[model samples]
Target: MPDPTATQALGRFVAGSDWRDIPAALRHEAKRSILNHVGCALGTARDPAVQAALRVMRGLGGAPAATVFGQGARLDPMGAAFVNAVASNLLDYDDTHLDTVIHPAAPVAPPLFALAEQRGLPGAAVLHAFLLGGEVACRIGNAVSPGHYARGWHITSTCGAFGAAAGCAGLLGLSAEQVAHAIGIASSEAAGTVENLPNAAKNVSVGNAARHGILAAMFAAEGYDAAPAAIEGPLGWARAAGDAADVAAITEGLGTRWEIGRNTYKPYPAGIVFHAVIDACLELRARLDAPPEAIAAVTVAGDALLLARGDRAVRNARDSRVSIHHSAALGLLRGRAGVADFEQPAVDDPALAGFRAKVTAALDAALPRGAARVTVRLANGREEETTVLTPRGSEARPLTDAELEAKYHENAALGGCADRAAAQIAAIWGLEEAADLGHLTALLA
Candidate 1:
């Protein structure tokens, strides 16, 4: 292969990793991320944002090559991957690699699925590629890290394009050099911004990442070459987009320490950082006897990361889903932050806003990323406090298979497909044994 830059190493792994030799825990984590992403995609497939996007895409239709999950229309492979990715991320309920805050599966799995379905690939291949892609994405993400993220780059899209392309390249059984070219080609188009998170644009970024990956691999398959040092060269992706790269994070321990093994799913639809706040508020709610009106204030103390992403005013459901205020309000008033709790009706509800105004988030340098302390002060002169060191779904407190299955059902129901959810769940759990991709395609609709 070309010079041993970061992308080439990642490409080699993507193209050459043996599925049979992958550790069981890493494989399970891959399945967990897959199950989480599939549920998220199904739930939001018919959402307004997706509907609008579908309309535009259908108007500019290409070959009917691949199915858009939860929709009848089959779009071109790229278009299908893009729409499926958007649907997966629309709810912001997918899994997250907390170290980089990148939702790995959203971008990687969509292209893998789209390409696999079009090629009639088996579930095992899709599953293996998905995991491999996630590893590549997260490692690249780890290299640029807080610097890339703090600089307003949406690491999921920026780093994910590489992962998506790498995975798709592997799924297509491309050579290591071809995989390297795919990674390099994707580097040229990597982008997304933190400013778009509260709007449909965020999903567009994710979708674009998925589409760009497929296109990158397609171009590479045709012998197109990217700059050899596309990812780590002085003027390449890392230097251009991020302040610095931790080379060690990207190059150390290839298959031994899998990044996907550290993935965490969201129990709430909101940003993962606010999950601890949700946990805290729900715990405080349990200790209260008075009505919502009796609560004078709710204070949430967490890492500075919480304030960076979660502390925001919620004018609509889009804003509400990423707002700590809504998370707190839902937990205190409704005792849960389900998918429906972040709906338009909830955003417009006066009581929700009133409850929101009482909640405040304070930056605490001492607390870990997933930990938070919530205190509620009541008009009755009572106070209750709860600290969640490990919110549910964190690797430290992973959701049980039963809990994850419940999550799948809840999400699948949102797309009005509860009737098919059970079967879909069964298929995903038994994905390795599946004979073909037909069952997955059918479930999407």
Candidate 2:
């Protein structure tokens, strides 16, 4: 017999896992990821993109089984999953696994939360499901690596379907065989292209992954069947979705060391890869004695991937969040970068645009993926440079618990629901003790 397949292993983990069996550290990380995901989702639940998507989903008229986060609307579990996933990721501020650049929580948590509420599940169970999902996401993400991402596939939504499916499967108490079927079913539906990254549809891709993954697990729980080798078999997910595969990455030490431990948060709303440039530029800005106009030219050097992904002009809020010029400009000229910095009026500022024009980004093959150097040339012939070897939100320099709580409030305020933040945070921290998710859902809604 061929060795166990990826689908089989993942299914076994999802069904066989016991919350008490997992380590305390892993459980804690799961809570952190959950808090971060909820904060991010609540923050952007009112965005135009999210609102528009919600409008469409609500118009479809499904059963009102779950809350739609800050929107205060109830929809079917699938609709809730779709809308919450979009909101979680619409800001591009969700948790990321550096090895795969996958926003691990956005696609998984929405489905998990929706199902937990639908089933009146306790927070402890929800946490367990979330951990299982995130682990599957990062491991599969590792299996595909740069090959899956470079080929124009958005790994978050692609691999994330598996995570969402596993999470929901765990919640539904599916058996190992049925959970494997869920993964197989999800593989057939997983898809998201980088070509969609520049618009609202990028968020839609993640939303689809969340919604569809839930549907897959729900179907599997009802006796749906799929190929046992759907993930690692020839002509399977690994070969079809990526140029190459690292089978060992998926199965080696699968359950021993937790991959979710490495999940990192973003301090800024922009892309994670651009964070080093933002850090360096902010440091240079702090040292400047001159006005915003003093800078003659700015130069940014970083890894080839950074330049390729971030070297673009800012024309709108969505573009601003991913642009190297916008990050360099806002950091140096304003001495700050935040969600507001990437929004309208701020993005339309003439002074920032002037600085935007002067910034040039180049690729350095030797620099690490998350490291950057920024050099500023002043009009009076003075040039200063700063290099950031470790960005603030990377695993090397993570945000503390207090900082994460502050971030949650900041996001809640941005979402116009700051008054609800304290209660939500309290409930999240005390999740395991709650009787069910109803109180939490009401607070979020």
Candidate 3:
């Protein structure tokens, strides 16, 4: 169990770079990711869950260090990061990286926004830090591969710890050595379990990752000590999580190969893995005009992994995300799935129950990750079938820029900032000239 050479190389690379050194493509991707995060955050701003968390945060009020997006209240960096990160993930609509299966924005954006406000930093700097963080998270995710996620650990919390540290380290202007220490410190603090799937606690994992990362960076900046080989050490992250660690993937194109380009946006509000099935169901619904009662049975065949890897025993809405039966049922009954699809009334609706009872899912041992085959049996003894090779909004069939913007606006409106957030976000993109992050922060308020 010697140190992993590849993980060590990645640490060195992460520890060495400055924001100015990131490439142009990476920068552009970073901006898009930022926009995506802001949109999702605004969408969840007014959610009861987010509001409840905000109220608790407000009561524990500390120094006014940074602003909470859409809430307009300032909190200490750690608290602000926690609340904002939770809000971004409240609706499960944040951007994700396929390689690591990590929700990139959930952990990256909160720290960047909080630090920007604390340091009076401009939008450009915040955006750069975000890109760097996403790159680090995705690379680490790739290094670990399907192993990390399959091990019952949530990627957004595990790989994301390092991402949060990188963003905070960049903003704090820590030296490479200090950044390395921060990475090491953050590694030890990482903890999340997939067992929390579809729970309000699921979103808490993301917020905790962001908050802990900030703490790790702050500690390193103040002369904290951590094992230099934390990532690559015999018992480090790779050995513990990755099936067969690929360190080269971690450091191969540092500062050049942007992981941000590989990031995917969610078109539907369910798990990324279930998007194709939902798409297939929606397409079938469009072609057939019948109510849920007219359906005899609905069958979905896709990556067996969905049925195999997913937790089928759903007790609540959050649990519904990982349940193929639940997602497919919602798709057939309502012709769509969203945050509202998993609500109590929706989940308990008699029509939805009838549809759910008719829905049968099996893993297509042959289908690929982004593909699915769905069959609907009509009460009239007629049957329809459709196969989706790739869901919309995936890199295989990306959403148009206009579609992306529309998604942002739609989510922003949900978070209670639909009217002005988009325009303000545009201004923030030109943040190199802005004096403070207040103008943008106020939009969330």
Best model number under TM-score: 2
The best-first sequence of candidates by lDDT reads: 2, 1, 3
| lDDT agreement with native, every candidate | 0.86, 0.88, 0.77
lDDT of 1: 0.86
Q: Clashes in each model (backbone N, CA, C under 3 Å)?
A: 1, 0, 5
**Of the candidates shown, which would achieve the greatest lDDT relative to the real structure?**
2
lDDT of 3 by residue, 157-199 (tens): 8888888997788777777777778888888888788777667
Query: Candidate 2 lDDT, tens digit per residue, 1-445?
Result: 8767778988887898898989987887888888889999988877888899889999885789999989879998889999999999988889989878899898999888888888889999989998888888889899888888888899999999988998889888999999999989998988999878888779888999999889999899899989988887788888898755677887787778778789999899988888999999888888987887888999999987788788987888888888888999988888899888899898899988888999999887888888888989999989999888889999999988788899999999988889999999988988877778998898998
Question: How far is 340's C-alpha from truth in model 3 (Å)?
Answer: 2.6
Error of 2 at 143 (Å): 0.7
| Candidates 2 and 3 compared by TM-score, better number | 2
Which ranges of candidate 1 are over 4 A from the true structure? 1-3
Question: Where does candidate 2 stray beyond 4 Å?
Answer: none
Clashing pairs in 1: 70-444
